[model samples]
Target: MLDYHFQLTRPSLDTIAGILAALFVIYSVSWIIYTRFFHPLARYPGPFWASVSRFWMVSQIRGAHADKTQRELHAHLGSIVRIAPNEVAISDPDAIKTIYGINSGFTKTDFYTPWRPAWCRYPDAFTNLDEPLHASRRRITNSLYSMSSIARAEESIDKCTAVLLEKMASFAEAKRTFDMAGWAQMYAFDVVGQLFFSHMFGCLAAGHDHRGYIRSLDLLLPILCAASVMPTYIRSLFLIGGALVQPRVMKALTSLKDIDEAAEQCIAERHAQLEQGKSGDEKDILASLFAVMREKGEKVDFGRTEVKVEVYVALFAGSDTTAAAVSSVLYHLMKSPAVYKKLTNEIDEATRAGSLSSPIQYKEAAALPYLDACIKEGMRLHPSVGLTLPRHVPAGGCQIAGAWFPEGTRVGVNAAVVHRNRDIFGNDADNFNPDRWFGPDAARMDRYMFQFGGGSRTCIGKNISLCEMYKMIPELLRAYHIELVHPEHEWTTHNYWFNKPSNVETRVTARATGT
Candidate 1:
């Protein structure tokens, strides 16, 4: 009787499995039908697979071609294209104000949640989506990134710039080829380190990614990109799985953990120094943050974790994007010989006129209209961040690019798409011409340029980045005649979140004075 009962139950288990499988198929079919025809966003033009599921978007992101794909889609589908079931990419310049402008009802989407580390107890300004919370946090930290603050912090930047030039000098002396992108990254990392923690990561001094931090950053981008499009529950599952699965997931986790540990260690050391009666003499960003905390006294709203997150955001967000911008400027300068010559002449004229100093001050560089134009053009052609900055529509819904998007809809502008809009940028939008920025439509172009983002959330670190590039580009060109090793070949880029360049090999020598 026991054997007969067991045999009957085994078939019952199989029956249950069959029922579950049938239900899964039915549910999938229903979801597809609902999203394709019955969904509010179904009327929007998009790829068929994209209209039905987020799988296509995720796959493209994972493949590191999402930016290019979006650009192509926008080119063919006009201003708006449904990249995912709930998300639309807007290429219209006017939509920038509507979606991300000051007091715009659109809040950040859940896409940024994964940006805040799983271990973090609270979100930093970058990861915080709540308007009030972000505003308060931004207010507290705003002065640290203000132009005056950055001007004071120029000493730290100068130090890092010196190290970078020294490294380039060595390459120039040896007549050796080097990866410009790598050196640019080293300079950026060290600059942020010096500015934030009063410590340099030694990437420039050591002549490589000394701490493995850069490599870790490169590895983590694809993971973050994939996580950005996943649903909240699925993303949570990934986090849980990453914690449990030691080997497979640990690789990515370790990279992020290393960065986190570095930040924590820096904070601990700073606290230790404070306990030992060490007064900070340098006007670094950390010093400024500490000052604010002290002013708040017992009512201090933020703590060590908050400080760590801010420093982490500074290092993580600041480094790669700045590096890419610097690299882009150099790449374009090299590609367009006339532009390069014109820029060199301007730098030389400034130097001869006793206007530009050695190591080039930010103010002096700012005055060089041609240099400014070139920087703008470089950023316009190849914006560091290639993905759409996603935002969620408010409860009442709104019109964007002349179409109404319902509440809870995701809408964003991709810099890659917006920067190339022929209507705003002209017919030669694809070309890299610095003169375009000096044209009558220049002001109009600036209005549409989404390189540094827009509105209140505009990158707080924008001044610092511009200061670095403004100083570094002129100084480097004035010192060395740099040439791409393979001028005929295009440098490869991997657009995860930041469009990072690889194999930006170049050979350098001292630039002939007055030539």
Candidate 2:
């Protein structure tokens, strides 16, 4: 009777569920088969399983040290290698110009999409992809970052440098053991704040963690790593179900909100200055932006949104990157005392002649062959923003390394691979050798250095960073002697965005500088 009723009416609940499950299995299988065998991109050579396997690629990226993995793939597969069904990893140095150089039609892929905080009150410069929007925003503030303006801001740079020196001097006076990482990071934060917002983090005075800048950055690191490796679909799911499943995302969003709020306050202060009819040149980055806006017109089109984006970009590019480079350079210096001694002697001589503070300039500093070599070698050996900064090929498609890549293909040049190329750099490529950057070899080395990237998109702050390091390194060496507390200490680098230092502690001691 039950069977008769089931036949006469609708199917049983269990039977319906079984049919649905079977259909789902069939659809998934067919999709995989079609993608692997008949898809438009099937001709591209990659790992057989990875060609149609999103989960495989995600797992590979999620595994430990994905950057090194990409390097190995480049070594084995040559310049152009398929990393995933839609991703190609290019190791050729020329690709840098093609990908990130001026008028490169490629745009940032969805890899950066999840970096947007849910409660973000501003458009972060790092996350903006619309070319026109990016161009407009960059244009409004480009003058502020121009070489002439940066050169004129020398007084501000000197002031900040003095602040850093004073802080280091205090540490020298104490003769106490503390983490160099903390101090270096604090100096970076202070410099960025003073440069951009016309304030300081006061981290050095506190001799502890400052929640002002570092706190927000620390919270965002893991999410940045996770987003890079995990599938976008998965991240979207978390974002969509954020209310229920992703508490950490909510916390990060709140922290970003706090950061934006602080930036808005700074902008408000600038507006007040404008309202007060303050005239002439301004010192910090925001003031410069204001001056440009005023020159353009009294009623420039920027609202709070524009201010937020510019601030976030300044915060991201200025602070954390500076911190990473400084910390890594210091790490290499301390580990190799010979190198440290050479650098210190140069600084000592420069300071004795009063060049450390007086007339300290990026051009002059960049001319210091030893210091330049040390900086480049450090960046090459331990690139802070290691791994691939991915870009998507345009609709017409692209050709790389004598191979045809289809439209919409995700592509990136692995920095580590290019810098460590045995062909270009030799067998000791992995070793830190500053001498390789001296004399005739220096010109050759320039072709492969990928730390600041290349062409028009090369870091606008490279000049600024050079000036800061040129002054700071000399001053710090003159006052203090440092040894790695953990000689075996290693920083964590990933295939994600930034190569971050894992929490590490280093010891410091005072040096007797005969002043």
TM-scores for candidates 1 onward, in order: 0.97, 0.87
Residues 1-515 of candidate 1 have per-residue lDDT tens digits of: 99999999999999999999999999999999998889988888899999887778778877777778888888888888998899999998999999999999889998998878766666777778998878977787788888888987888888998888888888988999998988899899999999988879899999989789898888677777777888777876775686587454567777888878877888888888877888677567887777777777247476667777788888678899999999999998998999999999999989999999876889999999999999999999899998999999999999888999899999999998899989999999988899998889999889888988889889888998998999999999988889999999999888988999878899999876734
Compose the digit string of candidate 2's lDDT tens values, residues 328-431.
78888877889888877776687688665554666666666788888888778767676677888878988776777767888888777788877677778888
Residue 127, model 1, lDDT? 74
The parts of candidate 1 lying over 4 Å away from their true place are 119-121, 242-248, 512-515
lDDT of each: 0.86, 0.68
The residue-level lDDT of candidate 2 at 251 comes to 69
